[model samples]
Target: MPLFVSMTAGGPPDQVTRRAAHPVARKGINDSPSKVIPTNNFYGNLMLGNQNQGVWTHPYSLRWVKGTGNSSSWGFGVSHIERSQFAYGPGNPNKYFIAPLGITSIILSAQELSNSTALTTDSLEAFSVNANLAVSAQSGPLVTFPLVQGMGFFTGVYLGATALIQTDVFFRTLSGPWTLGTSLKYKVLLEDGRTWLFYVHSSQGYVNPQFILRSNTTIQGPSGFRGSIQVAKLPEGQSNAESWYDWAAGVYPVTGATFGTFNNGSASYTLSWQKGGDTGKTLIMWALPHHIQSFNGGVGAAATDVQLYTTTKGQATLVASDQWVMVEKLVTDMGFTPWTPQNRSVTTLPEKAIVAINSVASSELNQDFAPQTNLDSMYFSGKGLAKFAAILIAVNDLARNPGLAAAGLSKLKTAFNNFVQNTQKSPLVYDQIFKGVISTAGYSDPGADFGNTYYNDHHFHYGYFVYTAAVIAHLDPSWLNQGTNLQWVQTLVQDFASPVADERFPFSRAFDWFHGHSWAKGLFESADGKDQESTSEDAFASYALKLWGRVIGDAALEARGDLMLAIQARTFQNYFLMDSSNKIQPASFIENKVTGILFENKVDHATYFSADIECIQGIHMIPIMPPSTLIRSKAFVTEEWNKYFSNGRVDSIPGGWRGILYANLAIINPKASYDFFAQPNFDPSWLDGGASRTWYLAYAAALGGCT
Candidate 1:
């Protein structure tokens, strides 16, 4: 029952021909070179496993540091609990559709932890995973799950083999449900910012597909600067689940819809779009919402032959214009409106209001990374397990698909090119960001601040941004051969990482914090306790080192690179309570396990918040050690290779583990070959994202790049 196959000769190894003892049985966990480490303080004595204590053995479980507490499950809890009308479970049959657990997480700080608490902080650095987990029972499904909306009166429109967005929902259906089923995909639009009308016009195809929602990404002022996003809503705003989503794409029309101006101060062709089934229309500028108007048909803006199906709860109750006139207001906002532009202008959202709106929007985007969210968002620490897992996924995709890697690099190049083009003619105050990242302040309310742009702290992420950008660049030197994208990438790297980003310590983006300790111990780099923090810094640190490494091919930098991998291992092994079973004991529910990084020890830890944990939990290792390390280090051929390889039994969840548990292991370890990648059910070519990041991974995998 527990036999293994070699998988060396392509296709599934014939069981009778290639049967053998499992790789794990032949080689112990340490047989692998790198692991996400766990320790009292990630770099503390606890990692030495001294201070003798009972070896709490749960087959897969390891102790948290010395002896803080016991962890039976590695956050293998339900992400979405399906409850009904307060029914008793004894016979009521209540249940939970628990998102599988194949991940573990550790949070890191840019600033030293001073408080005895875990959660509160200013900004974040990155995310990584625990090494023990990397070597532990890799579990869960590698195939991404759809962020599906339950559609009624209809059963399965999006259930076939076609790819769709089903994870990071645009919005949750906690209350009021939808009238029909709908789905969202992020790649269908362009980021030019000038195509509001056309974009809305194209959305007509979606109007009939249940209820699909797209956020009004053209964030001008959160004020009367009205635009509409449609969600699968229920009939007449009923709370009953009549029309849930079949499949949905969280489209941020902001970047996808708008393209900017040229050196001469003119933008791409301006577009006029009929908004929301023809009841309204929109105008976009510089890629943001310039105006939205409704044509009552009988009185204003002329009549159209096109019949319009209106949302009883429409995209906008009112539309805004530059004149500050309340042509119409969201019925909830209690305002009036006339159909014509002359009758419908409004002032920009107040300063304070705009910043708040922007913040809410950006926060959502940062957390959106599942199959399609930004892998590197400010919301995730560079020290979580899930994030590292995501990196591994990217690596696997690169190893499998040539097109994805090339696309990622090309997209990164295009984004930077747009930034360069925008800056050449505009103010130096332009926002330099990835396709959908927003660092601006909120603008949805009155009295919002639009002046003090988040350019300063926000720009720090640019280092990591450029680092990812550069990886793709190296894949194809020709990518930089002609365009300013390559030039700006080089400049941005210098702009943020060097003596420019931190000023005092040019190589760091260390944020400052106070009031901390979680049974963690560390040799204070400074008397006041200021030192480099975080395991997920691999995104930044590895990039910097690799950039320099590739340029000069130095050995020292490679050695330094080990710190990221080594420390991540310590955090997973020593920091948290790993328990008798191999699962990570979640620190908090609402915080997504990221806040746990603030502690130095395992027990007698800082205060924990009950609300921080989400319904679902996973190890936050996806982002930290992006699979780029797989290539950087040549350990792929060894026993550790099993972590990413499989003999068709990769999904052997002998113990409890989840996420892309089996598939990721097969892809990361060198022994796992293209045969593993070629499985029709597990194709890497069709993945999701604002843009498929697989394009970048393709280069890393030697698909089309010089590697």
Candidate 2:
């Protein structure tokens, strides 16, 4: 669990010591100690739950850019690479890896003093204030610090002020030659409850290694507090030797070329600046009572690296080259490389995929199939066939090892017998299309369509069985060719994938050449003409036929399958996927830029139950038979991700759609796909309970170059 920081409280309880690093959790799922663990999770869990975790917490991103035009000179000397200014947090991950900015200075406000000016700048130049460089003060998020005792800003000021002033400016886009500066003015209530006007300056330039901070009060009167300055360096290690500093005397002008200090007290606390030593990193001079507070949060010396100053109330301005390519430069500078699972291999997949499959299969095999008493024969036969097929596929994939193979083959043989019992024409054939009963069960109405509606899902129902038969045949041709009573599996395949003809099932009975797509309306009569609502399953049916043909050495059938694929690809893009209004689909069906249930004359832009649009889109991609370029050329993947998922909205998505989106993403953004799949808490619930987690993961891992 991540340690929660209560920004509301002044600081962590007194007993809690600031540790240099937090304890790490167990090794990540599929992670090896030798591999460099990614600090950011890449928002992989975004679809599992509503809460943001994983890579979603990363607030900044970098992209590489090549210089062009006038900006060609950018990134000339400094590694010949330029980077964009860092982006602010996206806010939902709820955890922050503290990266401290440079020195922090605060002025406690005792009363509301708005009219005063607040100037903030980030630069590496020496501390000389130019009067002309002032911007208006605006109230925004508060920047605060703790009131620890002995801290120069604390014990010295003793003003008991829990709040401080901070100001910042941010530019979403930055080009070359930019300055980083932030300055602010605000009133702070002292421990004595006296209001004092304070000025705070923080500045750092892109090329400079040093940033400066100056804090001083302007309130002057007989009862006014005298000016004082303190310097604090957030030491990197356990050593706090330079944690705080107090300027013993009052403020004054320097007279010599050398660094000096002024004092109203007897003892002199000198200030110096140069190149050789630690003292050269900073210098200070001020009068008594004017306290200076500067402590390195032990993270970094840069202003942006600090995390302890969130309580300071101020505006923050970040200025840098906003060039898009700069993000790539930044990513490179930060040592970020696209992560590939170390276990990936040509014959195997990442361990996580293997484990997920085995685990899911174990649970599935151990449980009995849910009763289908409420559904008609069509629903039972169709849904059960798909489930059975998936299980068989898993068993076969795991059968390479002798021990595992025996167990898997036994299960496969038993399932094959059971399958023959339910589907074969001899001995038992009650669930076949001709014997299927139109019983009153749930939403199933087999007779509603042309001959067997099953809610217009006949093709979907049969396609699964065909795909499974192909797998079995590939594994054991003898079982298909001469095994007792197993010729029936081929008969089932004919019922779905046979060439268009009479005597048996109509040639490609489900597919309509006129529409250039398969229609699932088995026997349903409709004003909109025969309609195939699930294009995903339609394509899937064709894919199954193609594979089965390949296994059986039927070149004619394979060619037919290819023809169907070519037609589906062309027609689906023209009629199903669209943007602007077209007569082929209803105007109402254009939401989210994807086509839904398309009919001869009607289009609904939704599936049977109106599920997530991406779910339907994902289905269309699942057959995994089309050339990857077909999917890429339409630009469907990028559009879908950018619309609903890029900003972490995927946290709301659940089940099969999550798998579909991520797996599809694997084709293009493999690193991102791996990021989500590799997350330790990756939940199987993100899969449609019917999906094979193992296969989905393995497919994605393979595409991403996982072995």
Candidate 3:
């Protein structure tokens, strides 16, 4: 069988013919190490060189300090930030919150590992990064560290190599070589008033690899030892932390490999360790705030006192179990019709709404839709097509105007055909090196279309196109089998949200199931790790996927999208959308309402393009569709508007941002939003290129604004 298989008969060509060269070259990425290819993950910096940025695992961050900074040895540098260590922007309510880095608690290294040793990743998976430390260019790795997110232990597996542990924070006391099951445990007290637990386990059984405290900051292990070393930090003032840790210490030597599964409205993921020592022992893992909120009833009792604070996602509770099942209500109720908070479809509009929708649809359809949509940037082009598609849907479904809908659909099909034929200004190419589809615009200019060729915001850029195709297919089902139309759209879907990991594309490249959200930053090394800006666009992409799946009759894809949206809703509410009642974010900063850009190490209340308050808030409200009501609750919208855009503040904001805010206001105050968009002399400048007045009116009216 060929490596790249198309979902439809006339789908994308083979990789050999469609492959194009990309500008940003990958470094140190192992060739076909494993079946999985993770482009945007927490451990992406491992592909970069020695000055690698931090890879966050939440509650803890690890980096390769290649004989630089405080440490003079090549090792996995570990650090954890306390709540007091955070730096905040100046204000009564701070604009941003950042966790401090470079506080190296310890460096877990082997004596053979040094600056000259080659650091390479062997296998890259959705949840883990396997880092290898080789003695020289041609020699095998002396140690392999499987670094996983939310793992309680920083485990290192050795191949008869000596262990050398050093800490920048001087060690104050070293206690215990006591045996707990098949492991030897030691408690180390650091000068910085932090306690750390270290355990050593040998697979050969009962062989003691004596570790001696050479100095205040260094510990040396016996030469030619074969086993694994595990390290974990104890939360301050938690008396039962050690007891809980000890209960699961027998299985600590066995590192876990994570895998996820989703079905119906429920999703479950498991971290199963390769069996070692006591077969009955359970694994110890940390659960993020969202995970704890959604965990099923099958798990063991959680260590309530043994909790650690994550950098941005609040507290992580210690759960000594292996599996977590998250049940969420999927958005199966939404479809082609205009959806309302009551979950009812709007078949007929009031006379005023019909008049307003028809007038705007006529004006929008008369314009040259091709020039507006057939642009070089996928982001802008997709927005253009989606804009017209929304207008057509509103005219046909709500206004009951078939003639105008027919005219609009014709123009929309012609505009969408340009992309299906791959004749756009900047054509897409199957990037064989990265194993995904990308825009050629970035090959010439790295920053073009916000680095689409480099894989930044694939979900945002491709989502609009998917939504447009879904609308077209729903309005005219024959379009599904028309000249590779379905196949072309499927290629884009597979590129961003492939259901399985295969040679053609990585599984869920944009969405991170473990994080309960998606990461927008791609193939870039940042000290803060992968970050996402527009939570609305992120949710919109999943919404697009859900509708596209429904229209094409793919139940599995629809279910996947439904589950993703559910997870995104839970996580966005917990981390991104800060309601007054939200306890995850800081009290001083939760007043911002929405986290502008949520990075692994920080959360900034600002956008990359503009620092304006409307841009920051309205970016999360663009293309407000059905899922918008599900994710952005009425309470959240009311709180956000009252905080930022209420009291006549929204009127002062210029450009398309104003329209986005008003459209979002429909979630809580539908009548006011409908009145604003349906005004006699509505300003065209207020509408974004991706938005249309017809759809906003329809959206508000469907939500009970048709007075």
Candidate 4:
């Protein structure tokens, strides 16, 4: 089974695969105490329960082992000795005399592997033996036995009781390596008052290994040192018959699992069983070598005449479906037959099981909630469409469950129709001149003052709805949102075409600020006073105008919105992205001394809401900007959508729901918005009255995959 038997001088080089690690959650600001967490705990402590995340393989053994535990033929990628049957002897011309007689080998190349060449080496190096045996034993004859004893340092002796039960030479190495030696030991064992004679052969790389010894009635044998009574050193007062045999100094690199000839030929296979605990514990070693699990399990060894290496599994195993795909690929590539899917699920690890389950759950939820009746639930906004759309946009992941994704799509389509129908009836009538009367929280008593303005800040409500619907439609097209259904959207978008007189919505009023008299900040900020309402009006309105332009896909619409944005940007400069300089004043008309007009942050949490109005509106004005801009922007509607995950869970945001009613102008369609909002954190419990309704839809969508 030698991998290479070519008389050719040089062969193709080994293939190297480089994997780029994906960006995981990096260590941000640590809020913990001063105790250092061991990095290794990241793996050792990670329990896969009784299951596993599945495993992958590197290139894999393309060649199949076509038999059972004992007799099998691994044609391709076989070890060097497997193909050659001859051993390299003193004067013998043949190097292949009985050579193919090992289970594996430690084949090396011209350039000995530098111990420091690799960064992530295995822990076995600290031990006494190299587990893999793939090399030309510098010693003599090819033969191996169960390790009986190992003692001393260099010039150490390794006792191997051969099966022949005859006196033979034992092996030892002092200066160079452990190889075949030309000496033997007499082992005398007493049984039932009778003395016995036994001859033991030895092997060593440095000495001639063609000698034997005879045994007598001496029954006691020293188990500690095999003639290894001293350490290696230059003798000043030496008086030995063979003073040249100085013991080796302390062994440098301990090779605890040193593998010589497995004693099994290339045609011979081995079946080694293992349990947890200790050095050779199978599970401990497997888990310690996380890189190994990436491949299917097992210590994958390579042994060709030209090369000896190790490989691992692939990435697809984490997800169950891909297991069969990879297995098929293995079969095809190896020119061997493939394995049937069979009972793979039973064999897979726990990680894969959990993943499969979660995938199904998310899928079901999306499908049931996405259909027509599903949208009928109070998913739309009475106060604003944008607000509702933002909350409803997390249907995409559900598609993994075809039923849920489909149902959700249908539901959203019906909801979209209802929106068009209702809006067409009223045509989104507006009483202009910055009325400031539309209380997004709902129809308030005449005295309850809120942001009831036809200004820039109010426009933030528009992007929410349109964006949600657009995101939904992008994932699933069942929501037919063309024609008159979009008229209401166009009318609201028209407001963005002109800059309003009131800075509350158009000019720039509220930011994530700290005004002394009336501090109103980002959606999640602590509102300190009354007039805090107007502080964010310009920001929100600006947000709406830009989004409207993009969804409408009209250059004039975009231009109109951009013009107003430019004016708002100039006016709201200090309110959001201030120069941190002079001019700490109040409003011209109301000299109420706005103390903390802004709260800046290196992280965009606070500043983003303040300036994100521009990013959102800018994208609307120019639809070519990156999508991340829209997702990251703190446009009013966008905030509502993000609210699903704000508390680390998905659900409708009560405070923002009303605003959703009016923000439909920004959505590409109904389904579009839903898809985008349904991120990994989506959950039905987020909504108040719609809890049961959303859950029902989720059930329908996930294709009855609860089990």
Candidate 5:
């Protein structure tokens, strides 16, 4: 189907479309490596089982066809071609043609053994005929084929045939119960043929797909053979949508035995059938491209399409839940429909999910608060501000008891005033970096420690400040321009994200557009070069800017933050979060490690803290993000939890990390995360002293996805 019937005058503007390249033809028939186009610029190399994995459109197709004989004879072919179809996009009109289809076909016939009769086979000539379009002409990977001579062959004693078509298409690989729609036609021309069966396979975006049998043809000796369309799970996997997520999803068709789960890679599929013994029967198969499974989740309430509030001011009267009302407004304005409780598990989280999150935010609303002991460290101090912000946010939640609002505001004011006054009084220098190092027992200088070893965490430290300021400003809009004291908070945004160059600060200092992410490297000198070790903090920085931009009415800055997020999301998935095992980390670190510090040339799965499983898991955990942002995918969450914290392991872990673990769980398994935090012992000690347990609980409650 044509995506666009006609383009506007200048054609669809070359905005950010899914990134892909013209298909590359195969160099040879058999030995050549599979050539694949990336699914998206951000999440490239999905590792879908097929050689070429992506979404392909009209006038181009990549194909793989092969034949195997039971008696030491086999043939294969691979090709790329331009289809005769109407295809056009943007300034590039009708430029969908690729030349000299990179195609090769080969056949080999070995000397027959004593028991096997001498096979009269012209393997080379057979492959040549097979490669010609006349025998098996195809427009693209998706098409319905009519059985023809040599389209699939079972010639020469004990021969069989197979053909696979790979397309530039994608399926919902994240947490799937995907459905594939197709009109398949096939036939088995075997009167005295040996046992033969057809196979179908697909990849789950991270790993190769399993080659599964689609036919019921068993090797237990062929009966009176009659072929018909069939829908079978094929063994370890399922063909029916309802049973897709089952643990026993994958099975071996040959032995009717179960293996591991199916690799749901959506890149490619192959169909094959074979005959052995004196049977000279040929198996023919055909398929037409149909709908593939997409990620599914529950729906949320209807949303309005406009800004939350005409002005960011006058929100002081509105508590946190009231603020979420506006958040829902902003979210809808940003072009996202609110998610219903039923479909909240997809990557796109709805406002209802946020509201449903369970947390102790209400409990901390009235509690008196204090700063962390290590105020000298920006990380600790900034978190102190975050605690105030969380409390203020909690006290204002519509679901919470609002009697403490007046008192909460007063506490917020006092804390902000004290925080600004103390910071100005301190002798800490704020130059290219925020340096306030002082010698301590564990380390000579805890303040300067960020600049030294954990050099890439500036975003993490500063993001807390930015988040806190945005919260206060949201609650009290006048805070931005009314007082000289509040000016410091506004200046922080300028210092960090001003597009223009300022001698006092660099432009968007930490972010790197080339990498589509921010670099965490600072004063630390190392041969490995700069890298953003903490993926969550990198996202946190953008999240802060987005919130702050909304508060200060900087549209450009806010858009920049959104774009940064878009790019960061893709980059994080492709690099920081491991999908299929690769050389970036050892097998032990695969799936278990979120990239700790990814240098240009080196990748380490180590964080600044201890390298325990909890720390590894916590490296990418961001407990707080506005309800609008979908920070991580459930696929990633499932892997992280299963690999590190599954079983009774979450119990032995102590301190704030326990809370952090629950927060991480909120992404996919929010109810479980909520249950963990809801425990009576889930107290302030479980929280990083820098954050308010009350707010943390509320944040989790909002994301817990259950009321």
Candidate 6:
């Protein structure tokens, strides 16, 4: 019955094009110093001016201070925030949480590197940043630091340079030049009473490279040193932790990358780090809570007690291994289900239900297809298209109204063609600077449409259009060969979820494989690092990718979507959607039921737009699609509803938020949700612009609400 069944056989679609230029003018972005690597990544701070913003490597935050902060010299500063250091908002169960910054424990620098020195970064991959410290702007770099996320040690690869280690905390006592293999290890006791381990290794051979104590605040390395210097913070009383660090000292991860594969209902991804020294030696790495929970048998034994609290992701355990294999069971069964909790290819609804759904669909089809004003925002325009597409799907599939479906599909094509033709008020432009398709609206006003021009929330904004295109193409497969229709949608997907690093777009721009989630923030400097607000929209983007992949027969894309969705479901349950039994978040904060806005340095139980309980909780529940039930599990939904919106509390919140909460409630109590929406006096204003009454009714009825 499918039009392009052969395309769905294997691999990605052969005709999917990767365009380097758009019809609109190219915004000149020639400021990038390193042209080889992608600009927008986890290590983007290294490319920005002065490069002072901290890049979060979980359990630790590293910054290229350039001699401005507490270290009082040009170097990289390392900071770790403890549980006691978290600043909380008012109330018994705090409303928000943030970790403090500028608390540097150690500063790794060189005698040749100072205020007069210059810095440039290259080889910017997904997880590593190579910072080259030079004597001046014209001279070559004397030392390079391969800064990587989750690395147990801060290593500096010297090319005939002198090392200068300094700290604001001041040195209290220094112990040992103990020889472990080819590394000379030293234990430093700081004024803050923390034990710091330092290791030095040489390329020529095993030789003691002495570090002369310059003062209470500075330690100078041997002149013209050509090897590596590694430093790490150890637990106060854990002697065993020191041995683990020493065992993995000589080797360091120069670059880190990830590869994911999915088969049947099981999916796994391997996070690998390429070692720069002593290739045979095992590397010491820190694993976040999510990593520790899903790690396979490939990793070595973990130092459980020797842990550090990440700014937002809870405790990060130390793993004495290089590669981590994380496996997740994908939701392979979910697809275009009409309105059921269980996935189905076909269903026969009751006559009365069909009649009601047809009437609602007809009414929705007659409304305006696209917004007449403010046509610039891809986010709003895409929402309009998706809303009508859902109505069309309901009419044809659920209501079995062929005439109405045909009428709606015609209007949907006209509306979608506006974007394909690039005739919208704010047309898209290829930002040569960031190498992504972005709106021109942000060019005139940087904050317009939630910073779309500046590369923020691309996944959330473009996902709706991608889903709508998939729906239209599913109903009319002939549309795939139409003018720029498929290419336009594929461009959006490549912008946000490109599987490979190409010449135009970066690989996986929005989705972060490391965090098990997508970051909404982009191209902006934040002290807390990247943050994502709506977990539902994040999941919805993945859902859209899955559907788009299915329609175009890109098996890899579909598999990635399934893997991402499965990983998100696992992580959201662990971190964001907290039940009573969760031990990952703080004991007091878990009572909030949901984390509203999670930043790299804080977990704020409030939305940026409003602090109202409905907005904060409902933000995670909008556009309750099929995958909604997967991510927002019945247990989590029940717990969240009972805590925040139970006992008639939801009735008082009079807005679209009320509808979202009820729709989400269908996961647990479908009868109650259906009854509320089916009320004779149901107000249309309660529904969001992106939602339709017909789909909600069908959704509820299919989930056993019509009984």
What are the RMSD figures for all models against the true structure? 30.1, 29.3, 2.9, 31.2, 22.0, 4.1
How high a TM-score does candidate 4 get? 0.26
| Per-prediction TM-score | 0.29, 0.44, 0.95, 0.26, 0.48, 0.93
Candidate 3 residue pairs that clash: none
Q: Estimate every model's Cα lDDT from 0 to 1.
A: 0.23, 0.35, 0.81, 0.24, 0.38, 0.77
Q: Write candidate 3's Cα lDDT for 17-52 as tens digits.
A: 366455655565565733445778788888754436
On lDDT, the stronger of 4 and 5 is 5
Task: Report the lDDT tens digits of candidate 6 across residue range 1-707.
Answer: 11111222212122332234423221122225324244346676665545687888777788776777555878777777777777888886888778887777778787877777777776777788787778876777787888888888888888888788788778888888899988799888888788788898888674778887788878888888888888888865666788788878889999888886677677778888999877899888888788877787655344345687777787788887778988887776677654333543335566777887898788878887767213768777777777787777777777788788889899889988888777788878766555777887776687888888778889899888888888898888999888778778888888888777666667788888888898888766676777877899889899898888988878778888888888898889888988888888887798898899888878989887897998888888866887787888777788888888999999998877888888787777878888887888989888887888887877776676677
| lDDT of candidate 4 over 118-151, digit per residue (tens) | 1111111111111111112232211111110021
lDDT for position 349 in model 3: 72
Q: What is the lDDT of residue 27 in candidate 6?
A: 19
Model 2 lDDT tens row, 1-707:
11111111111121222222212222111223222211111111111121111110001111111121121211000000001211222222211111222111222222222323232211111111001001123432121111111111211121221222221111122112122122223233332222222322222211222212222322211112212222222312323222222111111111111111112211111112221112212222211111111111221122221111111101111111100010000000100011222322224445655665566556555544433111234434444445444454544453123344345445555545554544321122212222122112322323422234232454565566566566656666665655342345445444444442223232334564323466665332243333555566676676666666666766445445544554455556556654443233223333344555554323444566546656656655553322332423336566666765777766667776776677667656766765676576888666654454544444455555244
Candidate 3 lDDT score at position 453? 83
Where model 4 places Cα greater than 4 Å from the true spot, the runs are 1-406, 423-444, 447-457, 469-483, 496-548, 559-574, 577-707
Best by TM-score: 3
Per-candidate total of colliding backbone pairs: 160, 101, 0, 159, 47, 0
Off by over 4 Å in 6: 1-40, 204-206, 300-306, 338-348, 372-374
Tell me which residue pairs clash in candidate 6.
none
